[model samples]
Target: GGAGGGGGRNRGGPGGGPPKASGKKRHRLASLPPSALLARVERRGGGGSFPVHCVAGGKLLELNQRLALEPRLLYDRPCREGYVAILFPSPDAARQLRSRLLSESEYLRVRGLSAEDLL
Candidate 1:
């Protein structure tokens, strides 16, 4: 309805500056296969350029391949700064792979990266 769970934030906190945008909302990634290898992508310039995370099979993170793809994702391999690759799993689980990288990816701390593997 209202851009998922990203709504209803108390903007009048602290100094009472304009309310900082609340975190993102988590949604189910639809249509996937079982145990398939996939990737989650949080493209740059989406907003604050915040961090995004995804996991599969004990953190299916092949830094070299993915790091290059998202120059903005923040992965120097072996370790990431803040928000960069903020997770080992997609902050959730799936039959195969999971990613909070799309418009559906949950917001900051929104929780549960469940994917729909109807295959």
Candidate 2:
């Protein structure tokens, strides 16, 4: 789960240069535990009548009672609207998590995979 792939090159940056090394080390987003929710649960058409929970430090944080009415919004625009929930342990933790996320090519390269492999 270490973020040490793509040969230290930063993708989508100006001139596609190397990622600037921060004073703090960059971690890998994959290092965190997966969400506890089950993805294969039944989905109601109009609205998702499911409970969303966030587990942090042995405590369960129950978020919304139901998901959005149009679940297709999740698939249509994942980055903007698709997330199940977000957990912010602290400001520093959120910052760390943001820094660890991989760029497109980095993610594929880290797993020794390609976009075609996903299909």
Global lDDT of each candidate: 0.29, 0.36
lDDT of 2 by residue, 1-119 (tens): 11211111111123432122222223422122334332222233323233222233211222221223445433333344544444335455556656867987997797676677544
RMSD of each: 16.5, 17.1
- The candidate 2 region of ten consecutive residues with least summed lDDT is 1-10
What does the lDDT come to for candidate 1?
0.29
Best of the candidates, lDDT: 2
Name the best candidate (by TM-score): 2
- Over 4 Å off, model 2: 1-35, 38-66, 91-100, 104-119
Candidate 1 lDDT for residue 25:
38
